[model samples]
Target: MNRLDNPILQVLESYKAAVWAKDVNALVALYDRDAVVFDMWGTWSYNGIASWRAMVEGWFGSLGTERVIVDFSEARTIVAADLAVVHAFATYKAVDADGLELRAMDNRLTMTLRQQADGWNIVHQHTSSPIEAGTAQVIFRR
Candidate 1:
């Protein structure tokens, strides 16, 4: 099926909406109860929804609305039976109230989803930003 028409693709749209709206409640609702996340900044991936909630809440609390902007592009999805994988390049920016950009990062993201009775539920997510070759520093997609 085309990506746009796929109900599975709603997972990403919901994610974009939740992040842009900075609504943690909305964010977790898209995930499976036991989802794991390969986050950009952390000792390791989050174990489940509870851990995920704490981290996301911290992020929204710290950044608020003015600082965080997220955009996703080049999204593609593959579905087979009860499994689905959606991936895209995401650009996110953090700006101060003065409109000064503190940081910006573009990263590739992949989410693994399972078709449940309700809908597709995200079970795992992995995100990685390209490193600058010259400086050997990560762009810090968070």
Candidate 2:
């Protein structure tokens, strides 16, 4: 991919594609060996290849096989020579485990990536749902 194409953005898009396909192996491949993923499930705040794979496995049962359509906005990638930070709004479509179309969720996601010998790999990712509109006050629930 062209560096001008925004490496971090590219990786984020690839991740969405992989998740949509429920291809766990491909999903894990996008992360560095020492990456961290934080989402609704709480702080998977520290993770690596093994934990990443395990997290993917955990989501396997929740797989709905529904096509995911992502609407991304407010995307900004701050790039250096070998490091970058990405932030964006993602609106997603997918069926829930109950087989009902999930209420569309607008999430704000931030990621940190490193350009390693193997190419751009995510070193950290944090995601949270939108509160109202463009606010970051996450309302966590069980």
Candidate 3:
């Protein structure tokens, strides 16, 4: 099957766009109502879309007037009719309104999507970034 036709792969475009736009509603719509997420900044894993909203909101809130750019790399999707698993490396760069990058991070990402009547919805997602063992410094870029 053509990868372009995969619902999980197709939804990623929407995800990327929503994140860049900082549209919490749009981002939440991409997840199942009962979706669970393990976000990089969240101290604990979020259980359900309701809980995930806070994380999404916090990200956008912290930006103030700044904008963020998101990129995904080395992404691969495996599908079995009703379910799809995707893994990738994701990068987030926060830039000032004037177009200066304030900070950036490269993270490991995994998302599981379920094909529903509407399309594929992310049921579970996990995001993480490694830290240096010696200095306890986060490895922001790869």
Among these predictions, the greatest lDDT belongs to 3
Tens-place lDDT per residue, model 2, 35-96, is 88887665546577888788787776565455555566788888899998888887776765
Candidate 3: tens digits of C-alpha lDDT, residues 1-142: 4446756776777888898899999989999999988877736788988788988898888888988888888889988989999998988888888889988889999999998999889999998888899999888789
Better of 1 and 2 by TM-score: 1
Q: Name the candidate that leads on TM-score.
A: 3
What TM-score against the true fold does each predicted structure earn?
0.85, 0.76, 0.91
TM-score of 3: 0.91
Note the Cα lDDT for every prediction shown. Answer: 0.85, 0.75, 0.86
Query: Which regions in candidate 1 have their CA more than 4 angstroms from the true location?
Result: 1-4, 65-67, 95-102, 140-142
Q: Residues 1-142, candidate 1, lDDT per residue (tens digit)?
A: 5546887777777877898678999999998999999988864889889999999899889875565677778888889999999899988887778878878888889999999998999999998888889999986654
RMSD to native, candidate 3: 1.8
What is the alpha-carbon lDDT of model 3 when measured against the actual structure? 0.86
Instruction: Count the clashes in each prediction.
Output: 0, 0, 0
Model 1, 108: alpha-carbon shift in Å?
0.8
